[model samples]
Target: MDLIIIAQAVGLFTVTNIDDIVVLALFFAQGAGERGTTAKIVAGQYLGFTAILAATLAATFGAGFLPEAVRAYFGLLPLLLGLRAAWKMWRGDDDDDAPGSNNGPALLTVATVTFANGGDNIGIYVPVFITVDHTGLAVYTAVFLLLVGVLCAVGRFLATRAPIARALSRWGHVLLPAVLIVLGIVILIEGGAFAL
Candidate 1:
């Protein structure tokens, strides 16, 4: 593996996954006290990212698996999640005390959200994948997976900070919904799902 290729892989992964830091941080805050939460999150992150890589790699191989238009629909996942959160707020259904109640299976929920949020990642990754040879592809995947672990660690560190965790706990319910809604809109627009 050339150093340039390694650098490119690192850069690409970092750029694509920058937003995931905050998402992971929020999850850490939410799962603060629960046993095995960190393990679940790390596993879910890997699961989700691996799926994204697989989809992108498959596309490179002429799998025709997920056209951009079809992938755009994945944005609906976060959009609906935001709407659901807003609905809960409207109905005065508090999730503060019951973190797990509305989230469904935590691991799957994280994985689903991660995958759904990866539409842009797929768009970026496929072009890069197309340019890379088999060895280069392996290098990229390794770098990406390594970065995922780093991201999880950083997210946990940030969430464990007193000020950061306190603020997130205080405002995350409102913030997460808005962020997800906006992210969904961005993904849809980027994918050309609809015009403004």
Candidate 2:
């Protein structure tokens, strides 16, 4: 495996998912005293992230057969998602869809939230994955999944610590929407959506 590919995978995954730490921490905190909650969270994270990567890989392959003009439209999904997130933020609406401490299956609830929150991830990843070869994509996927485990550990740790959790919560909620909006713009420009 190339070191450059590894480095790129690490950097890209970290930048795209730094906000997840706060989310996972909060989830962990909510399920702190419950048995099997940690396992459900970890499994759910993997399940959701795997689905995102699967979609990204499919889009990367599909993009090869599509015309540039059509491909440019791919940016719309993230742009709309970002706009929706910003609107919610402005309205001071909590993520009402978030998984709660209900008797329902925690894994499914967490997976749903993870997948919903990953719309921007698909937008960003498809472009990058399109640029990489098969080996590079495999490496990126492997690295990403590994980092998910690390993220879970970190989130669990943060749940046990109040200060860091609070600090991250203060910023993560505000930062992700902005990042999504910027990423949507960047993806659009890169794909020449505006030019089209």
Candidate 3:
């Protein structure tokens, strides 16, 4: 049981590396001018991620089931989502015109961006839950949740700092698309599709 939990946690951690990069980019892009805003964005991201993890785990433990074929199909989801993020990054529309204009939109925008950016993680989680041992699923879920929360918090903290924030924000646009493209290629390879 412990081993299973550890394996699932490791898998979740592996899958989340790409997600962390994307979420960090999104927050950095949105909160370019105001470092304080990064906190809210990070909070919303973790909230959305928690919600998705709960839902996916529920489905996996409940009557829901995921076959190997479905898992393979889901493996492609990340690649597609990565492509979408790459496109969004290339378009340079990460800025929210109404971020500080109102609290509601600000929170919602953060949640929406986090959720949208997290699509790939959400997709892969279902399979991860299904394949792992039942007893370990809860622990795995908790570990993933905590990992994401910590990563987002650290990213927000780093982005809020003056020098780092400015430097990261300056190159965020270029970095975002490049990261997404590389993630997409890696996911494709993992999904048994050659990017070449």
Q: How does each model score on lDDT?
A: 0.80, 0.69, 0.56
Kindly report which residue stretches of model 3 are placed more than 4 angstroms away from their true locations once superposed.
25-38, 62-105, 157-163, 169-196
Arranged by lDDT, best first: 1, 2, 3
Model 1, position 139, has a per-residue lDDT of 91
lDDT of 1 by residue, 132-195 (tens): 8999999998989999999999999999999998998787766767777887787777777895
What order do you get sorting by TM-score, best first?
1, 2, 3
Clashes (N, CA, C under 3 Å) per candidate: 0, 0, 0
Q: For model 2, which pairs clash?
A: none
Per-residue alpha-carbon lDDT of candidate 3 for residues 2-76, written as tens digits (9 for 90 to 100): 876776687767666555654464455545665466667667667767666765766676745443333334434
Candidate 3 lDDT score relative to the true structure = 0.56
The residue pairs found clashing in candidate 3 are none
